[model samples]
Target: MLTDNQRGGIIAGYYLGHSCRAIAKVVGCHHSSVMSWPPAID
Candidate 1:
């Protein structure tokens, strides 16, 4: 599971034009996880 801070970072990274693979590296998750995360953000 991702922390609130990590989820926030992923969102920020996504909007900033970072790739899912790159964001996943920073957050320590898989690219697929990153790809699946945005829609579920709440």
Candidate 2:
């Protein structure tokens, strides 16, 4: 289970143009985990 801070960082990193693999590296999670996040609502 990801902490709130980890989830927030993933979301922020994604919006900031970081790739899922890159965000996973920073967040210490699997790339697939990052990719599994819900699509951003515009």
Candidate 3:
């Protein structure tokens, strides 16, 4: 599971127009995880 901070980072990164792959790299998760985040997050 992602930490609260990581979740926030993911959301922020997405909103900031960063690619899922790029966000995943910074968040230490797989790119697929980032691609799957939107439904789970917002």
TM-score of 2: 0.40
Q: Which stretches of candidate 3 lie over 4 Å from their true place?
A: 18-42
TM-scores, each model vs. reference: 0.39, 0.40, 0.40
lDDT of 3 by residue, 1-41 (tens): 99999989887866644466566777887666446555544
What's the lDDT for all of these models?
0.66, 0.64, 0.66
For model 2, residues 1-42, the per-residue Cα lDDT tens digits are: 999999898778666544665577778886564465545521
Better of 1 and 2 by TM-score: 2
- The digit string of per-residue lDDT tens for model 1 on 1-42 reads 999999888878666444665577788876564565465443
Superposition error at 15 for model 2 (Å): 0.4
Q: Can you tell me which runs of candidate 2 are displaced by over 4 Å? A: 18-42
TM-score computed on alpha carbons, candidate 1 = 0.39
Model 2 RMSD, rounded to 1 decimal: 9.1
Distance from true location, Cα of 7 in model 2, Å: 0.1
